[model samples]
Target: MTAKHAFHLALLVVFMMVAPARAEDLRAVMEADNARWLAAYNANTPAAFPAMYAKDAVLLPPGSQPVNGNEAIGKFWEARLKPGDKKDHTFEIVSIHQDGKYAYQVARWTVVVVKDAGERTRFSGNTVRIFERQPDGGWLTKVHIFNADK
Candidate 1:
């Protein structure tokens, strides 16, 4: 093989090796974002979600109409976050893929709800989120959808 061809093949090999590392990095970032969201939810407030979403973001909750924009999404969360509810929430991230300015996550979530009446229930669901890379090196949720496990 020509020296130039060998060099090009080596470069291609290196680039191919780096792609998985980049995806791993993106997964870490997405997991951190999930942690922040869980922290806010555990605090019994929907304060973090709207801020994490883009201005024109869309939320599709199961059995409900589509929620458009941050304001509506904020309200949707507000209605669900109870003041004194005890809940243990977790995210099971299945995959994360990134391309240029966009990244998407396929994940599952489980929550254990404990009410004041000692009623306990466990709920699990699947979630998908699409995030857009901001100019400031941050990510904003461009689309979010959740479906309860049957």
Candidate 2:
């Protein structure tokens, strides 16, 4: 092979080796993020979430108006969530993929919400989260949408 062809072949081999590792890393990072997200939500700390998102992030929740921007999203959640509201929650990541500078995660989520008025309800649903790769090489949620299963 010519020098150029040899260089291209080596690059291809490197990519072949790196791609699987990237997939593994994505899964681990997504799992860690899921844990953080659930902890924040169950803690009733709406203020804790906006920083996990991009400045222009949007949150599309079920049976509610679309929440725009990181700040608005935080406020929207704050209005509905109270301390001791969430009794339990889980995020079961179904699939995750990264393309270039974006990664998307599909997860099955469940939560048991407890009301101060002595009401409890369990909800389970699916969520799709799109994360944008940041300049610091971290990921921030750019778009997050979740709906409860009827």
Candidate 3:
């Protein structure tokens, strides 16, 4: 084979080897982000919640106006999550697709909220979240929208 052809073949082989590795790295980052989210929720501190999102994040919860910005999101959670509210939440990642600096994830979530009075309410839903890679090489949710299953 010509030297030019050999060089092209080697480059192709290198790309094939690197592509899957990059994808795996991205998946790992996304999984870590999910874990962090679960931890933040379980921590039950509204102050700890907004750090999981970008400064310009928007949250679209069912039947509520969109909550924009990190501060607003934090306040929203603080208002709804009372001090004695017990929450058990779990997330199952359905799919995650990445493009350049952004990724969208479809996940199924189940949450059980037990009030101070021992009343339990269960909420299960599907959520789609758009995550942007921050300048510091961390992923944060940019847009989060979820609806409950009736």
Task: Give model 1's TM-score versus the native structure.
Answer: 0.94
The estimated TM-scores of all candidates read 0.94, 0.85, 0.86
Which runs in model 3 stand beyond 4 Å of their true positions? 1-3, 115-120
lDDT of 3 by residue, 24-111 (tens): 8877877888788777676687788789889999999999999999889988877877677788988888888889899988999999
Question: Taking the tens digit of each residue's C-alpha lDDT, what string does model 1 give over 1-150?
Answer: 999999999999999999989988998899999998888777877877799899999999999999999888988988998888888989999988998999999999999888999899999999999999999999989999999999
**TM-score, predicted candidate 3 vs. hidden true structure:** 0.86
**lDDT scores of the candidates, listed in order:** 0.92, 0.90, 0.88
Q: Give the per-residue Cα lDDT of candidate 1 at 46.
A: 86
> What's model 1's overall lDDT?
0.92
Q: Which one wins on TM-score?
A: 1
lDDT of 2 by residue, 21-134 (tens): 999999998998888888888888889888888899989999877888988888887887776665688999899999999999999999988787879899999999999999
Best by lDDT: 1
Residue pairs with colliding backbones in model 3 are: none
| Model 2, total clashes | 0
Q: Which ten residues in a row have the lowest lDDT in candidate 1?
A: 40-49
